[model samples]
Target: MPQTIQGFSRLNKEEKIDWLTSNFLSDSQNATSILKQYWNSDAKLQQLHDEFIENTVTNYYLPLGIAPNFVINNKTFAIPMTIEESSVVAAASKAAKFWMSRGGFKAEILGTQKIGQVHFTYTGDAQKLSSFFELTKSILLNDLKTLTASMEKRGGGITSIELINKNDQLANYFQLHVTFETLDAMGANFINSCLEQLAESWQREYNNYPVFSENNAEMVVIMSILSNYVPQCVVRAEVCCAVSELTEADGIDPEVFATKFVQAVRIAEVEPYRAVTHNKGIMNGIDAVVLATGNDFRAVEAGAHAYAARNGSYSSLTHATIENGIFRFWIEIPLALGTVGGLTKLHPLVKLNLEILGNPSAPQLMEIIAVAGLAQNFGALKSLTTTGIQKGHMKMHLMNMLNQLDATDTEKSKAIHFFKSNKVTHSAVDSFIKNLRQN
Candidate 1:
């Protein structure tokens, strides 16, 4: 039975913690001590972290790791990844190293157009709204000039704005569909600002239209916001090599591997059940990189999934093909990333990750992230088609299992050695450790 407190956000960190612990926890002092223990040693830096979001709380940390040896466009890079999941960084690193000798990855930006919308309900004739939109479009642009000035100087601004009718889907529904080029920034704030301005200007200017008086139908503005479905803001990353060069050190035939890889991608393309898991593996890599670089992974995930199902069925984001004795594996994904705004400039690790990446522009970051996804998918597919996925994955997960079981260092080392040749299952490890303690 926690009670609400007014001005909770205005409270200091210790006061906020005191309120939370007193209301929610059985031991207020212990909980407060626990929260303070996670605070940064530097008071100024800790204050910065405290102000990053709403009410201040102790920081929740994830491993900030680098997957080394990513060779893209003939330049080598050690990509940074921030995630809690085991084996993701390892898998990506392995894939990068594997493709490095085969001329590495090649990436290209396909497009860089972000989207936003102004939704409204117009009870009047659709044709009239369209005509009114055409007439008032310039005014919308003029109203956005102050907002778009800085973005325009950086070579990014509103690309297009169109009035779209959705009467069949939702009665009296319409949208001011807008597109933009945000350049090196994700531009959600910028895009939403412009859309809100357009909405405000349109509502004011519509009163003067002849149709407004004739029809007596008002245009009621609903909301103005940026869309996460940025299909046009896409990039492609691929690795191509001779089928003979695609062989593993384990003596697996190159042609056999290529055939299985291509078939695996085809199955994902045709089967929705498999496609979800398949695309998730790809996101394992994409999300890690996106998170590391301080971009919106949720937005990237939503847009990528939407693009995957663009053809009426959810399919694989990564594709593999064999043509003219060459094996090609690639992925094309829409990523609205920013290198200069949001957490990119705020979060300490994000700044380091970007610096580690040689400070790529938005398009360049898109290429890197897309390559990471493609590399990740390749690692997963290669494992699935050969050694089986759980073999390596469970091996990587053994330490976590050991920690959960509260094994001592000696026990953990022994378990690691034992599981190296034995199966890694909860029961098996539990039995092994129990027997070891008994002995």
Candidate 2:
């Protein structure tokens, strides 16, 4: 019989690894390799290792935290995420607990398809390229058949292709939007490859025209290089718990809190300055997961901000409201992420983290991330509405400061006590340590 290891968090690093090896389900050898690689003493390797150990890489298995009570589309899922932020996990769990008091999170993914664009520009004739797309739309669609076949077999395919002339002066550009169902993957690479092939075809077909110069015509510019226009997959959670349940946690008025939270988001949507931070709050969760999974966080960041400003103004990624005495939350983002190829396979720790997730396919992984983002947003908004964001975040920062000081357990306790008492400073901590030593 397998022995149950209780409270692994209380154990030392080595003890935790040992427990993981004996009973926790994971790739033991891989896990051991990553631990050893970082635990070594080589300076450069050690530096990289330390970064990995921290929340630097999101996929480097720190702890698998779960947000329980998430009822999406009538199914309950314990959403597992790898993130190191202090209040994110706690807040999400709190939100889920609150929602459980009502009907839970009712969510639906509109479709798993994502759109990628290939841009064509020529000085001579926009009309010509426009006509060309009209004439060769079938050919372009047929070329994507192999690329999209697997998705097609799974009840998804390259559904539509459209050509739009972007009004611009530097170059007359035609944007081709290819929509394909990605099943459960993020679909960046798949969509990019498809667009690459399309661009190559455009070059071959329009090579004869002087204005369509490969050297000067700007024949292909893959704008929105990654997929956007994600079919709106709406995930919503509403709970009708008595205002009583709110008291058990922190004496928060669920109805009043929810109403105030919605108002804050409305302010963020209408105001550019607030919109920046509002979206940043969303990215706080997104960037954490993107880093953990070994995906390009910068790209996701760029895409998210661009998507927020798609309507010519910055706006909040999530909308919140209280209806019928229940808190309702909804989020939509251009989450361009992937599970196959790239860093997902290149990095050792990323592989380990994915394994912890049971190596979910792309779409499943996206769903998990989407929910995590929603949960994280809830965490931030709730904190801002109830207690203010800095209170909880600053306490976590104080703990980090103590860790950096390399204080002993006793020293840490003393330092924290002094810090809270307004007597702690760099010089003060030094004096306290010196006094302790002298005694």
Candidate 3:
């Protein structure tokens, strides 16, 4: 049985590790060795990692890979990706190279608005609440000037604030829906702080209203926080080339391939079952770049999926079309990214990724992320229409399975050669290994 320990965070790093291993680990010494093995050789860097969060433990590492030959807006970039998935970088690189000769990807920022909300319950007359909001809206906006000054200096701050009535759905519920422009930072903390300040100002000013005096009812604020669903903070990435440009080495007609590709995208657009996986393939590229650049993949995922269902049905984030003797594939997604705050300035690899990406501004980063997604979709659709997804994906996945079995160098070499001509399946590899061992 384990016991809860108080003041656990007060313990130093080594002591905390000692207590954890002694109590929870079956082999305490081995566990300690394993944990220590991941520590950075540079003491200063290790200390920095330790202080990044509470209850410091050994560092965990993921492979950082570069997907090269991404040409966007006449400029070339080698996008960095941090992911555990084996084929994402390879697929993105293949797509980038495929488009490099076909005029590459073109990306643009559609908008750059983030949202926050202050929820409160008011039992007063709806008419009175609306009147009060109209009267006090400027007060709420003006009250936050001090908070917005720094953001304003950077050409971003509060964009708009509106009162929304939601009593029809939930009893006595109303909200202050606010919009913001955070130029380079992710702005979670900044948006949250401003919302809290607005709520405080509202509560203070509500008592002076004649409506509140007449009704003797208080406007109770439930909470104030930033929203991750930033539909307006959108970026669009597209690639287009002549239909005949989509030539095939496998002898399939280019026109047929282009038609199949468009149909595949349409299927994903209408069918939710395929759309989920289809969108996931897009995220495989988007999330990889997002993670590599040290932005929040979870938030990007939430906003993007919400936008996909903006038409009331979950659908593909990427769309494809072939018309007027040309084929075009593109994606429009809401991505809130930063180039200068949070982990961007802290993590070494994040800084390196930013440098490798030409240190794009928030909007530029959005364009990059969106292009990554579109490129990934193009790659997937190309394979899906022609060779089928599994043939290449399983081939890329071969190394992982081989690693799991801990095959020797000689065995791995043999397995790679064998799988080149034959299909890769776990049973086939297992039998191959078994026969190799027996012989």
TM-score of each: 0.97, 0.70, 0.97
Better lDDT candidate (1, 3): 3
Q: What is the C-alpha lDDT of each candidate?
A: 0.91, 0.65, 0.92
Local accuracy of candidate 3 as per-residue lDDT tens digits, 1-439 = 7668999999988989999999899999999999999999999999989988889978998899999999999999999998999788999999999899999999999999999999999888888878888899899889999999999998999988888999999999999999999999999999999999999999888987777878877689999999989999999999998989987524679899889989999999999999999999999999999999999999999999999999999999988888899898889999999998888999898999999999999999999999999988888888888888888998999998888888899999999999999998888888888889899
In order of lDDT, best first, we have: 3, 1, 2
User: Which residue pairs clash in candidate 3?
Assistant: none
Q: Mind giving the per-residue lDDT tens digits that candidate 2 earns over 293-399?
A: 87777877776777688888988888766656555567777665678777677666677767756686665566556666776677787788887886666655565
Residue 226 of model 1, lDDT score: 94
Tens digit of lDDT per residue, candidate 1, span 1-439?
A: 9989999888888888989999999999899889888989998888888878888788878898899999999999999998899899999999999999989999999999999999999888788788888888888898899999998998889999989899999999999999999999999888888888898999998887776888798889999999999889999999999999987734688889889889999999899999999999999999999999999999999999999999898998988889999888888899999998899999898999999999999999999999999988999999999989988999999999999999999999999989989999888988999999999
Compute the lDDT of residue 353 as modeled in candidate 1: 92
Q: Which portions of model 3 show Cα errors greater than 4 Å?
A: none
Model 2, which residues run further than 4 Å from truth? 1-85, 98-103, 144-151, 154-157, 168-170, 208-224, 227-245, 252-255, 341-361, 414-439
Mind sharing the TM-score for model 1?
0.97
Q: Assess the local accuracy of residue 163 in candidate 1 as a C-alpha lDDT between 0 and 100.
A: 91
Between prediction 1 and prediction 2, the one with superior lDDT is 1
Separately for all candidates shown, the number of backbone clashes (residues 3 or more apart, or on different chains) is: 0, 10, 0
